[model samples]
Target: MEHRALGRSGLWVSEVVYGNWLTHGETVDRATATACVRAALDAGITTFDTADVYALGAAEQVLGEALRGVRRDSVELATKVCLPTGDGPNDRGLSRKHVLESCHASLRRLGTDHIDLYQAHRFDPRTPLEETLVAFDDLVRAGKVRYVGVSEWTAAQIAEALALADEWGLARRIVSNQPQYNMLWRVIEPEVLPLCRREGIGQIVFQPLAQGVLTGKYQPGAAPPVGSRGAGFGRAPRFIGRVLGDAVLDRVQRLRPLADEAGVTMAQLAIAWTLATDGVSAAIIGATRPEQVTENAAAAGVRLTPDLLTEIDRTLGDLVDTDPTKTADMFAVKAEWARA
Candidate 1:
């Protein structure tokens, strides 16, 4: 797999990062999860992403076990905080107590001395931004976290945090932002991308396939395939329902011919399209089976010509969501939940 520098930092990550979100410790069993991780390593993927909120921290345990035998220095492990890991008030958000305790808990679960990248899962409206940054800076100073980042944060939120970090002379600034980006979801392009580009914060994008919609497996006018995420096989992600509409599915079908012309699967075409975008350091792909990992990993270095990209845009015209405000809207929803 080809590697790229994560923003302006010296850290390098594989173009295709294997992530376990809904699969590990949720849908797929531990043995299958380990197999998928092995497939990722076999494909030369050195970066793995997980979160404390996924399956209420079971995902990290599964991922930690999967990478147990691999050389510690040979891989970059990333996880997130700021999500509720329990029902207690202190169990969530980016408060200093939560952030510091979460870091130690994540370290114990991942079986690592320090995290390669520790991210704020979401912006905490309930906590002071400086308190959050100070906690992250403390983790860096204490040698628990190497780099700090945020997920699905608005450009304004990021700018405010960066300004505070600079003003306070924190040990580390944000290095990356993890957002859900795909051919269908272009919300980050207009605002977040340009801001991060200028700020040197690379994007570690998730759901590059639009929660499997871009894979063209869901039919336009039919029930979702059995056992698929849309079929709700096992605790499906809530976000997948938004993209399962017939309008989106019909437009997604139009991209199949383009994938055919490129001599790649629908999934590969979708993933390759994300990598082609500037300011993207890596695209995270989750897999239940090892062969799926192998198939998606092949998209890491595949180049899409300008003509093909234009054709894709033309085919999916008007079906894409490009509103920059969607990021803030999502943040607001999460913030309300935090208040509750």
Candidate 2:
């Protein structure tokens, strides 16, 4: 696997980060989860990302078990906070109480003393930004979290946090931001990508394949494959509906020719495209089977030529969504905290 610096930080991670978003605890059994993790490691994937809220933290527990014999320092393990792990009001968000408690719990669940990177799963509007930063700073100082990041944070939200971290002389600035990025979803491009590039924040993009739509597995005007993720087996079927439409699927079908010309599968072509994006540090892929891990990992070092990339752009020109308005406010406090 190819390795890259994680957004101007000293840390380096595999270009293809193995993530367990919808597979680990909920969709697959323990044996399959362990086999996939082992396959990822065998494929030289050094970064693994999960969240405390995934399968109610069972994902983390399963991931931890999978990595039991592997050397801890050899891989970069990351998890997130600010998601409700329980019903209590204090069980969620970036509040100090929740942040500290969540980190401790994550460490225990992951069977690691320190998380290589701990991220804010979403912007916590109810909590002060300074409070959140300070809590993460404390974790860093206390040797619990090595670096801090945010997921699905708007460009404006990241800027505010960066400025505050500078002002407070915190232990670490946000090193990364995780967002849903793919050929079809360019919401992060117009603003988030450029700002993050300048601020030295690397984007660890999730859903790089548009949740497998880019794989060309879903045919236009046909029912989704019986056992596919789009067939209602995975989590968050609501968002998949956007990409499963006939219009989008037909456009995606056009990319198969390009994939064939490149001597790669449609999935590899799509993954290679994301890795080629300027500000991306890693493209997270969630796999259910071991062979799937190996197949996607092939894109780690595959480079697309300028002509191929241009052809891809032209084929999917109108289909792309770069309007920038599609960027969602996960915290629901855009009016109060967003910059003008």
Candidate 3:
């Protein structure tokens, strides 16, 4: 597993970070989660990313249990806060009270004293950015967090946070953003990627396979696999436009030959595609099984030729959104090289 610096923060994470999303408390058993984690560690995946709200906090507890007996120094643990982990008014948002409280809950669940990277899972409009940044700074100063970051933030929101942090002379700085990026969806290109590149902030994208769509396991017009997330994650409810509409399946089908030629699965190809770009610190891939971890890790060595990359992009066809006004544009970021 190759390591990359996570933005301006001195911390380094594996190029392929492990994530626990739908799998932690739903599809995977404790033994299975441990096996998957062990496989990732064996393959040198040093970073494990999870959110405080996943499975209503079961994911964090399970992850902590899974890491038992493993040397802590060998792995990097990254987790997020701020997603209504509780119903109380103080339970959510980046307000200083909520931020500090959430940090403690995550810390207790993960069984770790300090989180390697702590992120605001989404923008909290109610909380002042000044309050959030200062609270995060306090965590770093108090040795509760090593780095601070934001997720699913627009470029403007990210800029505002940076400006506020700079003004405050805070102890921590925003070093990374976690967004969803894949061959089928590239909204971050125009919205957030450019700002990251300009500020030297690293990016670790979530859902790099479009919530299993880019894996090419689900053919057009076919039912989702039994016991799979798509069939079971009805409550999670993926956006219809991104997941079901616009012939995403057809485009995914066209990539089969390319993945085969590279001696990898479509999932591997999609993950590698994200990493091939500069400023992507890591591609966080979640798995329900150990084999999926191995399959994704295999992508580390598969490099797409420039011609192949261009061909793939052209075939994928305008999946990377350029307009900032569209809701989908939040997902499709403008590529730094994209002609405005």
Candidate 4:
């Protein structure tokens, strides 16, 4: 697998990260999940991303077990905070209590002493950013986390945190931002990309395939394939709804010709396209079976030429969501419950 720096930080992550957002504990059984994780490791994927909210912490447990024998120092593990893990108000948000407590819980669940990247899942409007930053700073000083990051934070919010970190002389800077970025979902392209580029923050993108819409599996004007991600299996339906429409599927179908010409699967083409975007450090992909890991991991080093990228754009014209206003507010809509 190809490796790139996590922003300007010394840490480097695999170009195509293996993520267990919807698969680990909720969708697939433990054996399947473990096999997929093994597949990722065999494919040279050194980076793995998960969240405490995923499967209500079972995902972390499964991931921890999956990496049981692997050397901890050889892999980069990332997880997130800032979502309600319980009903109590303190159970969620970026308050110091929650952040610190969540970090400890995650460490125990993930079976790791330190998280390579501990991200703020979303910008907490209720909690002060200073409190969040200070808590993250404390984690680093305490040697519980190696790096800091935020997921789905707006450019303005990221800038404010960066400025505060600078003025306060925090122990570490936010090195990464995890956002949903793909060929069909370009909402992060305009503002978030530019701001992260300027601020020296790398983007670890989630849903690089638009929740499987870009894979050309959801047929236009036809019911979704049985057991597919668009089939509303488990909690995936909540996030897959936006891209399951006939209009989007029709446009996605047009990309198969391009994929055929490029001699790559539609999924790989979609993944490679997202990796081509500016300021993207890595693209996170989820899998149910071990074979899926091998299929998606090859996109790590596949570079698309300018002509193929242009062809893809022309084929997917007007279907792409580029409006800066479309960026979801994690605190408001909750459209992306799986991630920030």
Candidate 5:
């Protein structure tokens, strides 16, 4: 439960944040969600990340109900907007109307008057960045949201937001960026990650385990076990095997020996390995069971050795990009590897 600063915003968050993207409302029942949140809190996790679109807001309701007994002021709540709750034209994107309305809706669902962190789920090319910044500024000025952030946003988009915020005297500042960054997905490393560090925004990474791919759950020749994320109703991304392509699976298979040597699950090794980087402020961990929560919490302090990091670099086949300057080097290497 080590606390790390969320950039220069001064909001201290636990290194291992509890994320409720799946199982909270879609697969797991309310009681189970409550137990999971309690388990995370008991393990010293203070930051909880959820999205309004997750389970179409049922996730927020469940999280709000589950955390009722806990001290609200002691916890840092982070949620997102900009995703469609319905098919309406205004139901999605970063429009000022949608941003403001969505914030209130999330507040009601989350049972909180002021969200500690409010983030845009993605870059909205339709709405002008000025409109989004002004809306976020309005929320911060009205004390509805304590801070502003973006998820899965590119470095260029984030810079544009910052510039607009500066020019408009906006009350909001981009304190953090939450992107999918795991041992398998390192696309954030080259540009977006370094840009966050340069702009004083923290990197609150999501899917640090590649949704159990790094957990060694899907054996080479065996079917996925029952009740796993891939086997549950929340099964599209992980089950589609869309993200678990051969390159990803091959790298994962290669890491088994390294994880065994470290006396840690591959999940822990991957999570700790991500945190060992320079700019990650927190790692968003999705745990369905109490034991999983406890297991991932150990990721906060575990350090990867230089030798292990080197071995991981070699096996991961250009996944973890250490140098911001050589941004496209890894991509070129991947192309060459594919050709070979």
Candidate 6:
């Protein structure tokens, strides 16, 4: 797998990161999850992404077991905080307490000494930004977290964190930002992309296939395939359901010919497209089966010509969502959760 520098930091990550967000401990059993991780390692994927919130931390344990014998220094491990892990008021968010405690829990679950990338899953408006950055800085200084990042944070929020880190002379700066980016979901392009580009923060994007919609497996006007995310086989049908409309599925189907012309599967084409974007360090792919991991990993270095990219845009005309405000809207939802 091709490796790229994560933003301006010295850390490098695989172009295709194997992530177990919905599969491990939720949809797939332990044996199947181990097989998937094996497939990723065989396919040259050394970067593994998970979160403490996934399956309420079962995912991390599964991932840890999956990589038990593998050389720890050979792979990059990334996880996130700022999500509810328990019922207590201190069970979530990016407060200093939660952040510090979550890192330790993640370490024990992952069976690792230090996290390669520890990210804020979402911006916590209720917590002071200084507290969050300082907590991350503490982790870095204490040899628990190597680098700090944020997920689904708006450009302004990222800027604030960077500014605080600079002003406070923290030990580490934000090195990456994880967001949902794909051919259909271009919300991060208008502001987040440019800001990260200028600020030296690489984007480790998730859902590069638009929650499997870009795979062209879901046919228009037809029921979702059995065992698909939209069929409620994994976590819930909520995320994939948003893009299962006939309009979106039909347009997605139109891109199959482009994939055929490129001599790659629809999934590979979808993943490669995300890597083609500027400032993207890696694209995270989740899989239920080992074969899916092998297939998607092959898209690592697939180069799409300018004409092919233009053809893709022409095929999916007007189906893409590029609203910059959508980032803020996501943050607003998280803020509401904090209030409640």
RMSD to truth, every model: 3.9, 4.5, 4.1, 3.3, 3.5, 4.0
User: Candidate 6, residues 1-340: lDDT per residue as tens digits?
Assistant: 8999999999999999999988899989999999999999999999999999999999999999999999999999999999899999999999999999999999999999999999999999889999999899999999999999999999999999999889989999999999988898788899999999999999999989878989999998899998888897544576677677787887888899999999999999999999999899999999989999999999999999999999999987766677888874432222221232
Cα lDDT for residue 242, model 2? 54
TM-scores for every candidate against the unseen true structure: 0.95, 0.95, 0.92, 0.96, 0.91, 0.96
Q: Write the per-residue lDDT of candidate 2 for residues 174-258, one digit (tens) a residue.
A: 9999988888777889999999999999999998888888999999779888777888655556556656777777778999999
Number of the top-ranking candidate, with lDDT as the measure: 6
lDDT of 5 by residue, 277-304 (tens): 8889999898778889889988888888
Off by over 4 Å in 1: 328-340
User: Which residue runs does candidate 5 get wrong by more than 4 Å?
Assistant: 234-240, 318-340
Candidate with more favorable, higher TM-score: 3 or 4? 4
Clash pairs, candidate 1, are none
By lDDT, the better pick of 2 and 4 is 2
What alpha-carbon RMSD in Å does predicted model 2 have with respect to the real structure?
A: 4.5
Sorted on lDDT, highest at the top, how do the candidates line up? 6, 1, 2, 4, 5, 3
Model 5: which residue pairs collide?
none
Question: Which regions of candidate 2 fall more than 4 Å away from where they truly are?
Answer: 234-236, 329-340
lDDT tens digits, residues 1-340, model 3?
Answer: 7788887678998989999987787668899999999999888898999988888899999999899888888888888988888778888888999899889999999998999899999888898778888889889999999888888788889988888888878887799998877775566777688889999789999888877878887777777777666776544345322464426666778989988887778998899999998789899988888989998987775678898788888887865554545422443433421222
Scanning candidate 2 in windows of ten residues, the lowest lDDT window is 331-340
**What TM-score, to 2 decimals, does candidate 5 have?**
0.91
Clash count (model 5, backbone only): 0
Task: State the C-alpha lDDT per candidate.
Answer: 0.90, 0.89, 0.81, 0.88, 0.82, 0.91
**What is the number of backbone collisions in each predicted candidate, taken in the order shown?**
0, 0, 15, 0, 0, 0
Candidate 4: global Cα-lDDT? 0.88
